[model samples]
Target: MVFFKYPEQIRRVMYTTNTIEAIHRQFHKLTKTKVRFSKQNNLLKLLYVGIKNASTKWTMPFPNWNLAVSQLAICFEELLDATLDL
Candidate 1:
């Protein structure tokens, strides 16, 4: 049960639901600011658009793909390649 994150911008990844809650805060903001929409569908549209925009600027995967895959194969060899058919 270990996790690692890059040192670029976001530091340690906490167990708490902080990131999701932060996004939910944006939804709350939309409901408050954009009052009196003609119908419920418009509210849904606003929330969906806001989340889509936020996700676009998210940080990318860790750059060293090969190294990570190799380490994982070694660590979980029993489950990944457990049999020898050939």
Candidate 2:
């Protein structure tokens, strides 16, 4: 399969959809308690604050990230080269 072509480290990162789902769940939780917003900007501000707080918790980098990047570069040499050129 196409997925099997990548290294194990890359595969692990690829299967981390739960992290995204957790962020969405957190966003829902943050908005759920607030029934009404005075203006559209107020709702936006709340979401912006939520994002900022969530980002702070993401300080940890992926394990073996350099190895994953190396594997990805090998798998998509042309693509990475093109991106780096721009």
Backbone clashes, each candidate: 0, 0
Backbone-clash count (model 2): 0
Question: Model 1 — which ten-residue stretch has the worst lDDT?
Answer: 8-17
Query: lDDT per prediction?
Result: 0.61, 0.82
Question: lDDT tens digits, residues 1-86, model 1?
Answer: 23443332222233332678878887887787665899989888988998997678565655554564455556556765655221
Off by over 4 Å in 1: 1-11, 15-17, 60-86
TM-score of 1: 0.47
lDDT of 2: 0.82
Shift of residue 83 alpha carbon in model 2, Å: 4.3
What lDDT tens digits, residue by residue, belong to model 2 across residues 6-71? 888779879863577768877898999888998999988888898888889887888887887788
Q: How far does residue 52 in candidate 1 sit from its true spot (Å)?
A: 0.6
